[model samples]
Target: MTPKEAIRLAINGRTDIGQVRDENEDHIGWYNHPSLPMGFVVIADGMGGYTGGSKASQIAVKCVTEHLETLPTSTFQACTPDQQLLVIHSKILDALNAANAGILDAKVSAPQLANMGSTIVLALVWQDKVTIAHLGDSRAYLWNKDGLCQLTSDHSLVQEMIDSGSLTVTQARSSRVRNHITRALGVTEFIEPNINTYALIQNSLLMLCSDGLTEYLDHGELEFVLSTHRPALECCYRFISEANEMGGKDNISVGIIEYTLENKVSVSQANISVPAPSSAPVEDVTVRKESRA
Candidate 1:
């Protein structure tokens, strides 16, 4: 049986031009594979001038998805979680190199595509495990009983400053170089992706979004919506809408995945029967207490 008929998942994705741009260079997509505990979803935000940016993001998404599709199922089942993660780490670096080469070849004669690059954040749901591979500033968040936890650290200049103790979390948020990404696909032939694997629990929700969403919503807001919401699709839409309502200055894209005891959740049909968040805003900014390495 196909994944559609075997395991059930709810997915809703949207990309907006936002309040700042005439074109949307962000892309998000989910692919459900049959006969495996694997689900692939990716979100890419391109950075370049016009067509170059859009094309670079599209290429990154396509390359990663295609590479995953061609990978043997034995790869996932053949090793421990840590070993699998290492293999995935190697694959991401290899794929980024290939993508960079492709982008360079495409831009050899066209100056418009010369300096194009993209931030890639990929999530793989396999059985009870959530594997995340990320570069640039896009992020992954997990929502459970403990609330929302950021699964990846951004590869940006501000992040570097924070690491060096040159900037505080509050200062990094409003830093001039906050948007300046330090790592991305196609910018360099050698790229390193931070890879992690989490043991997912039943009735958990995983969210993947570009920086556009985080630019507005705080962790408390995310926890409220994700933990309280029943339908995954609505949560995804509300996220994008809220981002736009709060002055979306860049392209926005979001993808959601909800885990269950059995594959019973329907994608088109959502169970909209959950309690709402408290009528309060969570604007508290907490200090960073975790190390990136």
Candidate 2:
């Protein structure tokens, strides 16, 4: 078997009500099927008021989990690697769409939840690869010996402003419109998520989280926590605790996955340094736009 097919993964997840939030609207999930070589980790941040927001996030998690659980393992295993990736990508999109429709239907049936919405980030792992899909601002980060890098971009207005050169990163962070998101599930009839696949580096780590943790931690802080060489579950707890200590403005949810080869190679640590914010204005970053089917 190829190295890609001979990999194993360790995963752990946690969610907490921050110091300020009365109820936690963030939901996290990780599942490894007994019969398949695939697994997934998901994080969702609910929007709107407490009742609507929590319900929206819960529904999104449930729908995605059920969809993945019911996928036919035999059919997936029959495909080539490339074909398998495409199938997984399609299923991710379908699952998101299904959740969107379900949320919309719920809003229609219950007038009180009319404004409910959610941001979702998911990572699907199989063999030595990970397929990431996301909507709105929930994020995914990759960490290895090279340090940590954000794999998913935020769909928030502040992020757009920063990318377009209209606002600096420092300015965007404190902007009044920082929380305004351009894309979300359950807010409309349809949603288009950004999806990408990457080959997993042995002894590397992947983190999926809500904005709550990111709102308090910067790139350097995140790198520090992830590079501690701790167990996946410990890492999840540490991230949540640190976020809360930093003011914990929102509900925090974190999911961590550690990928390793059969031989258990060790990952080296790097002296991480934060880059200074760019002085020159940046051009607008183009996103892969999608329309409803």
Candidate 3:
């Protein structure tokens, strides 16, 4: 009889105030134990150009991480794949909802903080799969030797226009209303996040970041740097530097979790068509969250 081995991860995260912002409104929550059955990395960007954006980001990260850790760790580590997904899926929603409630409640206690909100993105690694969820423009990306796949889409007015063919990617990048978002954590009574999961692919690197990083760099530029497959720390450093170099007009934040399975082959799945870099960004053909290895 053979025994199963635990999966390993190289996790790294960083947030910068950037050259333009006087305050670093971004907050990060990361549990980067090298060997763990489950863990997560979360990043929230304060609604830039608004009062209390920084404080709102702080509260959002704190609420989500604190609420998510309330899960049944022992059961999560030992449950069947189907059961694990159910547990984590429910937890992610609960945590996000708690974060929203926490922020709204804060507004009632302190009216000065009203209208403040933040964009959130989270990546949860449980067993051998990564489940992701987000609101607003914060993003999650999956990268390996094959290429980069953008997992989450932006929740912004400009993005809505882009989706409806009213604007192109290039125009959206240069739009004066680029930072305006349609959804956030503390602004309103209701907010729903987009969530998905994928089987853990060995040598796969998951990256999460604020719109600051995405602002200066697009998908093609990101894939170029990640293609090197450098250690998570170095890659993060480069990401920040590049963003700053390209007119770091806003706060820059990033989190990287590179996965590796010692002495084991990568998880195999059906019908993943990831293409090489081209004029257009890589297409997403990765497996879904419900599908386990």
- The best candidate by TM-score is 2
- lDDT for each residue of candidate 2 in 1-293, tens digit (9 for 90 to 100): 33444566778899999999899998888887664456789999999897999999998999899887765477888897778777887788778888887788889999998899999999888766777888999998878877676878788899888778899877877889989999999876657678777666445788999999888888888888888747655888998899889898899999988776776543221221222223321122232434343
Ranking by TM-score: 2, 3, 1
lDDT of each: 0.71, 0.79, 0.76
Evaluate model 2: give its lDDT.
0.79
The model with the greater TM-score, 1 or 2, is 2
- Model 2 misplaced stretches (Cα beyond 4 Å): 264-293
lDDT of 3 at 167: 97
Instruction: Predict model 3's lDDT versus the native.
Output: 0.76
Deviation from native of the Cα of residue 141 in model 1, angstroms:
0.9
Worst 10 residues of 2 by lDDT: 268-277
lDDT comparison, 1 vs 3, better candidate: 3
The TM-scores of all predictions, comma-separated, are 0.80, 0.88, 0.87
Candidate 1 backbone collisions, by pair: none
Give the top-scoring candidate (lDDT). Answer: 2
